[model samples]
Target: MANVSRQPICTLEPKMQNTIVIGVIIRSQNSKIIELARDRFNAGTRAVWNFTLRDSFNDFINATVWGTVEYVNKLFTTFTIGSVVEVINAKVTERKINDPNEVYVPSVTSPFTLTLNQHSSLIQMHNSPNTARYLKFLNMPTKDPGGATNLNHILNNSETLKNEYVDVLVAVTFVSQTREIVTRMGEMTKIREFEVGDDTTDQTVSLTLWESEWIRLADKWEPKQTILFLADVQVVFNEKAKKSILTIVRKTIITENPMLKETEELRFQFQRKPDIRSTSLYAVPNPNSITKQMMIIEITSRLNNASVLPSNDRMQLLVVVRAMVDDMNLDCDDPTLISYRCAKCKRLVSDEKESCMNLECPFGSGIKSPINITSINVLVNLKDDTGYLVGCRLRDAAAEEAFSCSADIMRSEFKIVSSTYTT
Candidate 1:
């Protein structure tokens, strides 16, 4: 590592050359191969990778790498998030702020963007003693969460906010499995759905993930554990659903688990509330507000709306269902009748396991003993005139209330009942 003249991101200017810069990669996007048309019948492919880097002084800027598919993709895959990277000879270009294409770029505090090419610019990991300071910037939100639009206001004034960009701070409630669908052009694309809620509202909002980079990053998001500060999310009105929905466009930049006063307050708010589904937060829902009774078909239609999961715990749809229980295994002598979950992290633990395996949990390390709680875990099916609802979880307090017995008592009675039935 030869000593080179380095400049902070704040002082970088357009057309500046021969100056090296170093920063931490706060965010990165997946590399994409763009098809370039050379002639009527000839075509070429180029790769592009975009990422954001932040300096120790908190100045942040967006950077892009462009070259052949192999060249750009290799650089993108080599650097890890939050790692310090040094760039040499990268072209500093003035950003086209008013251009229509700017809408697709992440909102950054910098006035210029850095363009790194395979021919001249070089990017590599730079080890430094100040690496800890740069990594701390990862937890800093790009925008203040306190200034974000309240969730209740968004819900109430959805129509007014349609197509408007807004900032939000929310907790992850549910992350859906990724799915692939064919677009109008017959191109296959990946998408993942997320439900997020905040202290201001009982309702949960949908945030869809379109890029493969984001979808892959979402794998580590745990419901009720992960917090997100999303900047420049577009609020679009869905005519069919007759509601305004928040969408993560290319312009949206997200900060995970932000270290701020507001973040601690929100976490405390969630801790004080009883663990209930998406219908309400901070307190149990009023029985009067849950009067929207729907048949199984209508309920299924709403769940399939691509906005949320029906049973998502962050915000639940509290509804009165007048249906018959088609199937239940209350008296079955099954070893899986009871569920063990870590008290600290709320993640399921196997019966043989003594602790939560989630490394993020406080007790996940073997040095500490994990506290596990046991609860009744059973699935039931309900049928109505319209359709059938299958695989509904009847667990925890709801399970005990429905069966009129504690999980331990139910287990004892289940074995006796099973033996009697067999005899």
Candidate 2:
């Protein structure tokens, strides 16, 4: 913390292009950069040590402070994470180029690159305000996961799911014996995966642990230690297995902060259940708020129906599926269920249906009523405090509300052209 002698702090924003900003270093990746780039920047390595600074408005920027053998050795030497400092004449650079092939967002790792050179001034703040006071001054939104979904909910509610990290309360069921694997880059990395889940689901998702000098997350687990895997657990849908699995890459955070009551509850309530939910932390929802209202209703998260299984709630609700859209391509997974119908009668038919085949029906006589998508459905697995429920179907109006698209559009690649294109 730094003492500025009551000097006012300058708030940093994307709107301010080339300006010096003073803020607290709430996040730092100096060590990660050093480790990952150790081989690349081995001797006389000139690399940038990245750090994120938060201003009074809770606005944070990831700044890459360049380090060299002559000028600056490395970042975090004078200030660590949560240290306050005044950066003189910081310039915001363009976003780094990303692979266009990826359907996922560019990643939080890609932000307006903030760089500071040797000529720039770095003044550390010693008597900075406490977190309480800083928060008050920042006026940032309170961090709250009001409607976090469990594994059951995740498997069930597809609309509410986004590309960002998820929160789960999982109990590690099985830890595979450690193994060494080679990455695509020909780097030999030791890796291991384990199954974790809550009591609300059928199976557990996999969480991978890479080999590190100090078994970071693995060591954190005691004979049976439970903690919140706060964010960074990547949700990957295995198309072959037809289920979503979690990937704990290097960015994952495993912590048991007693201050977080939900995490404590998760820690204490964890049982050796085959299918359980893990309490993870996801700070925000997808920012996409676009929705359409009609006879259909959309619901997100879980309905908390753990007391029973194979349930259906007609509660038509509207919630932001939150595409988590950035200025990039949105994370749109293939819809779980597609609806098909007899083209002539508009009656529901299987996707493989060639004709109506009804002996008494006119369309069944000889007409080839190729099944067209009429409506799509989604299955929701929900959990309440009482118990867990699985295989709850969302159809008709509910699917329309949640997916923000008609059943026809959801089932096919064609969009609604116009009123003239109506079937």
Winning candidate number (lDDT): 1
Cα error of candidate 2 at position 32, Å: 8.4
Q: Poorest 10 consecutive residues of model 2 by lDDT?
A: 281-290
Residue range 63-115, candidate 2, lDDT tens digits: 66765533444445556644567666555555646645222221233355467
Q: What is the lDDT of candidate 2?
A: 0.47
Q: What are the Cα lDDT values of the candidates?
A: 0.76, 0.47
Supply candidate 2's per-residue lDDT for 333. Answer: 45
- What TM-scores do the predictions have? 0.64, 0.42
How high is the lDDT of residue 24 in model 1? Answer: 85
lDDT at position 393, candidate 1 = 76
